[model samples]
Target: MTKIIKSGSGKELADARGRLAPFLRDTLVGLNYAYYEPPGAQMLHNNAIFVRSHDYSEALSTEGEQPWKTPRLVSSGGTHLAGSLADLPYALAWVEQDFIVPESVQSLIWEDLVPSLLTGAVLPRWWRVTGNELHAVTLYQRAGEELLTASAKDEKLRQMVIDILSDRMLPQRSGRLEKALRAGRLDQVFPQIMPADTFYLASEFRRRFPNDAEHWGPAGKELDDLCHRFASEVSPERLSQDFGVPHPALAHSYSRELLNVKPFPTFQDYSSRLLAESWDSNNLYWARLTDEMGYPPVMLNRLVPQLTRRMVEKLFATNLDDWPAILRAMQETGEEFRLGKTASLPKSEATPGP
Candidate 1:
């Protein structure tokens, strides 16, 4: 199914031999798998099998004077597997194996066992059996665009795609979000985008850890605890109904924002826009948007703390002149913050207890 004699330079052929394990070197002697250079004079046939590197440098290390076979094989690519070993870097061993092992047992090793050892194979049955949505989301990300595109076409992938979105467990952009939109299943996806508890969890995460660095304690045990607690409290049907789904307009706007539809404007305008949108639309209009589009309060509050000095500088400058005045206005009065429209802080309504 694949060409046995691929063309390569004689030097390249030599370099490939240098990388081979001693066991492989000894076993695969006199195998001229490559077509040499110099107009094909006397064929300087290399006595070693050369395969295209599939990041197998460690596997081919000669520390033990043998090919570095893994003790237990696990797929690096989660559920991504090629149709054949001939399609993989393992193809170098295909012809070579026949020389060492008998033909009768070759298919058993090359076809069945070797493919299982390579990446793109499904996760272990135990891992799948655990039914951890987070793990599934990880696998989905590792699968990358190939899995995502396939999800649009394949029924199993489509179902898995829906499940991933429905879980709403992934914090990062996992392409499941985009896939749901493209597949015209936003209705299924949007309702669960921010689970009811997500508002609390996201808010708590933001509140308890203003500095992002503090939240990540030694492999993220601190964050994991919060996530575990949130997971325990999540009830898909109940929370979806409580939080409610966004309107078509809000969903479209939010999705566009996530996908970054428009290019970023000039520094000041961008900064002003972010502050205005976050505080005005999200904070000041939280109640209104919740009523209008079923937006969670978390959406309103999440960006407030993010409007730091560093964020401003990253956009353009060290500081925007208007930011201090804006911050002062926000702190002084819990009202819509706009430039040059100052309002006195309103008095609190409290009845005196006699």
Candidate 2:
């Protein structure tokens, strides 16, 4: 007669321990278990033991000098035992009293007990737990799939996974990311690049501190004026030389007009171009680019306010000779030309208010 033998719980436990033993060994190595020795130069070399007491009468109480009068002993000692000697004093009282529980069985009990004891009344946040678990499982599955699927094929997917992991783990700052994005370098390098969620978060932060514009110092107002001039049909190359490279989109928008148009471009046209191109009317990109191009903030700060007025007059003047005259008039009058503030000029003749 043929008989079938069923695998017992002990067999299952053994299989689990076989899998977890390597990780446990690694953890022990990390904890410097090899160098660890008890106070009396006693080396722990045996399997872990666990003891349960139903009542205080069954539990052994110990103190001071020799906590365990009788040292715990395990059946067939190999490595270290990981249990309190006092808790299992009955088993320790006599080596013959202790029975061998499979390492797998011990591990299973430890796995349950540790989490149960550590996990108190409060549970980890659901999102955090889910994210960590999902990330781990995802990476594991991906690695397994890559190994299996790419064995007979090209190594593109495997390489991609490696690259992604390396890049994701690399230390990168969002400020640098923002700088790249704003300069359009990210889009240039990776054509499909989209602005990160961090950009919107930065925008929100700027919104919260609107007065940060004031702290931009003199450079901020100069950048605004330069952007206004560039948007109003001023030659981008000249502006680029004088101020800096206008934003690609902004420069493109301004260059669409006839080669030589008189009276330059209106502030309304400049404002419209800025709005249409989605460039920040208040926070111009040219100044940022100038700074990125290695111009010192302090020098740019001093130059920008003066340079914007010069560039505006240079662009708006009917003839090149008119610049000296306009500059002379500006020098004579305390009022700015852009603001239509001249000492001799009448209030009625000034540029109309919005």
Candidate 3:
């Protein structure tokens, strides 16, 4: 197993720095090492390397006639170097010259920090608006590039970033996120995405990667509101391909509901059989049995919507002829109702109506 190096902010950074100090200082000084740390989020809070910089101090200086945005740094070390810098290229040039500080050995900033910092996710501890619009644009570009790079490399990380980007709805979402989505790395996240974002992320995934149904198809299966939407949204071919005939939830729910009746043992047997078979035959057998129960048309008319509303509408609208049994059942129900009404009327009224 690759060792999980604690490399980010807080005690993790301190611990890592302490463990590899002199070697780290040597590495940083000569720039002669080929060290590539694992790709993960780095903590910039309490970053020792950036806190001692002149730009960082100026950004934090309360006495200065500058526009620093809060929350202000109260503790000893907490500032993002890439974000805090007034100008990155110029600032890095200066930082290289000033790298002879004592903290270089103590802090031992990782080379991986370069790529991780480029992710641009770490907000500055404090920043001043210096009328240079390029500062903000540069930060965005740097962050976007790293996010895209990181996302392309790891599928789960890509999904996490996609979830974050799903906040604004697609097209309206950040171009960085859009680029991430287009990278086409879709996988289920551990602990799953939050309930609110699941459907949105699933939706965006489907809209963007229509052919990659397997990725987004089974998402939001646990949510009641999204169940019908999931079924209706995907194309029939993709639905069949990805979800194995609509979805197991819809099938299992239908079987559970339909088979729950008197003649308890038979109900159980039928349910088990349908569930076990999990084929179109099960749907057909149930449809026939429901029709035989003296309400074929109304049964499907009601039950289809319960399974999925829009799908049923599309089926009935476009493929009515395909379900002759349902049509016959509906006609028979209407005829039965009319005849029963006539039979219940008084003889004089019946004769007059005749």
Candidate 4:
């Protein structure tokens, strides 16, 4: 078994610093290493990471003009890892010098994330804006260059769903997950982790009453909200599961807190899955599902938005087709959804799949 070193243990903070110091040996001489932890958004508060230099106190210093925009140092040691930090950079300077970004990759430093990193907001997850890249903020995996950012995870999840709904047999990617999604069963997805078939009833309740905030609360808002809760960091079971708890939204929020959101100057720093990272760039990540076999992107769009919306409304508001009429209407729209509530005769009279 491979052993890993942790940056923050109950062990003395000085010992933690001592353990981390050797990793910075090759970095600049005067460069100091700063470990960061954010003030979490626990009721009436906000979660944030602020950076300025290789020191935490200065990066978050209110004594200066604007503490919120301060530029803070990226921590060197991996949280639960144990090994050579030899390949890791000592400070933000090393992060800049060693940034590994792809030539074709685009940095999405919207108005919110970039300026914060410039002054001192050290975010640590998929969308975290850093000096040169929006990295996963990982440590143990970087020396080997196998970082799987959250955007990559979301893309994979989307692809997995499409693959399951494709209906036609193809190369098997995740057979179990595909099967579960096809049958609309979440219990099979993680039976061991989640012992009970809890969400099945909950999800049905939300679908039936999408706006029943009084009882369902946030889960009642949208199906996606329910999915975000139920479908947390599932692919990377161990690492992500550890971070998945508390709630769905909080699952990957602290990926950076676990490691540094380093700048990968090139694509080589990313995992092989980075090739699929182009999903966001394309307007239709689900285009293949729609174009090839005729499954529209989940979001309503100009191409055939009304058709999908009408189909959805009919599925809920209207009765099941007693004749071939509704079947023809569904066929015309080209959606993969089933008429679950379609009316049928008794078992003796009605023959299925006819």
* Highest lDDT scorer: 3
Predicted candidate 2 versus true structure: per-residue lDDT over 1-354, tens digit per residue: 011124447666677778777667556543432232211112223423222111122224322243333234333333223333322212221231122222222221111111111111011112222222222222222222322233223344333322332231222332343334445353332221111111222222233444434322232334334435543322232322222212222344222111111112224324322322231110122133223333333333333333322222322234322222222322222225334443332233322221
Which is superior by TM-score, 1 or 4? 4
Mark the regions of model 1 whose C-alpha exceeds 4 Å error after superposition: 1-223, 232-275, 278-321, 334-354
All candidates in order of TM-score, best leading: 4, 1, 3, 2
RMSD, each candidate, Å?
27.2, 33.6, 31.4, 23.5
How many residue pairs of model 4 clash at the backbone?
25
lDDT of 2 at 273: 26
User: What's the lDDT for all of these models?
Assistant: 0.28, 0.27, 0.29, 0.25
Instruction: TM-score for candidate 2, please give it.
Output: 0.15
Compared with the true structure, the alpha-carbon lDDT of candidate 1 equals 0.28
Give candidate 2 misplaced runs (Cα > 4 Å). Answer: 1-128, 135-139, 155-354
| lDDT for position 76 in model 4 | 42
As for lDDT, the candidate ahead, 2 or 3, is 3
Ranking by lDDT: 3, 1, 2, 4
Summarize candidate 3's per-residue lDDT along 248-318 as a digit string, tens digits. Answer: 22233211111111110113323422222222212222222233333323333233212221111122212
lDDT of 4 by residue, 109-211 (tens): 1121111121112222222222111111121112111111111234443353333223322234245545554554545543311100112223233344445
